[model samples]
Target: VVKWNIDKAVKGDPDYIVDRINVHYNIGHLQAVGGDSTRPAGDYLLALNKLSKDQYLPVGPDLPENQEIIDISGEQMKMLASFPTPPEPHDAT
Candidate 1:
């Protein structure tokens, strides 16, 4: 997870901080309920990973996509669960 000062960003300053955790595969898209709405954002953040890779059970040549459930209730993001999707999902809400 990364933290960026919006005030600095508005002034064209590069005062941003970044923190990263290994989610185990390539993540494509992410979404949370009411994330972009006026209401409060959801507590869960879903990471749509493009490849399961070494993160899931062996499926030989047909590896399923991964959906990593992340908990954003605290200061840091925590990965709660990982689920498999046979078909790749383009986006989520």
Candidate 2:
């Protein structure tokens, strides 16, 4: 996840402030409800991770996708839960 200062960004002053946490594996996409049009975004975010790897039990070469539930309601983002998904989950709401 990433954190940005909107006030600085609007003035074109490099507002990217932090790198946040590095999830278990590679993340394909990050999404939230009403994210695009919402002013403060949403209180939660779903990290669509591509590979399970060490995140779950070994299931041969083909690893299940991981959907990481993140809590963005507070000052810092936190991983709340993880659910194994079928193979490739292109997108989520």
Candidate 3:
């Protein structure tokens, strides 16, 4: 996850990048609490990664879906925890 400070963004700011935290394999979708609504909560974020990539083998299969909880309350994004999610047959780009 890359936390950006867009409030102070200017032309020379270089994408307003504040910090970054790596997830397991491939990050697919990201959902912050209330992020899709008018009242977006900025405290935490839920990251959906497409592949676990052996990070969680006990969960089984070649690769499993993963969800990671990240703390975004501060200037940098921090990885708090991660868990395997049930596979979704449908794929949405």
Candidate 4:
């Protein structure tokens, strides 16, 4: 027997929801209901960003402190200081 609850549960996730909405809207369904235009654009975008959490956050300014780290160590530091050539890449033949 087909299990409707299981099927519905899988289809109801956030990724599934976003994908379905995008597919419908993008494929000539300009007047699709309950999508971006129906909701306040700014509010909907903000909610989507919050809902997506790890995926949609802006890259640079507001990223968590630990995420954007420019580690200057070893050869990187030497090169920046104009010290000398670092090391040539290994030729794997």
Best by lDDT: 2
**Per-residue lDDT over 17-84 for candidate 4, one digit per residue giving the tens place of the 0 to 100 score:** 21111110111112112334455322111011111223334555553111111112221211111011
**Model 2: ten consecutive residues of lowest lDDT:** 14-23
User: Least accurate stretch of 10 residues (summed lDDT) in model 4?
Assistant: 77-86
What digit string (tens of lDDT, one per residue) describes model 3 on residues 1-93? 778777658556666888888877677887888887898878888888875666666655556678888999987778898877766423221
Q: What lDDT does candidate 3 reach at residue 70?
A: 92
Q: In model 1, how large is the Cα lDDT of residue 68? A: 81
Worst lDDT window (10 residues) for model 1?
15-24
What are the Cα lDDT values of the candidates?
A: 0.71, 0.77, 0.74, 0.21
For 1-93, candidate 2 gives per-residue lDDT tens digits of 776677877888874564386678788988885676747467888888885666677687677789988887777889899899867887775
Clashing residue pairs in candidate 1 are none
Please, what are the lDDT tens digits per residue for candidate 1 over residues 11-71? Answer: 8876543334457667787777677789957587777888666656767667778888888
Sorted on TM-score, best first, the list reads 3, 2, 1, 4
What is the TM-score of each predicted model, taking all chains together?
0.67, 0.74, 0.76, 0.13
Q: C-alpha displacement of 92 in model 1, angstroms?
A: 2.4
Candidate 2 off by > 4 Å = 12-19, 36-41, 57-62
Error of 3 at 74 (Å): 1.0
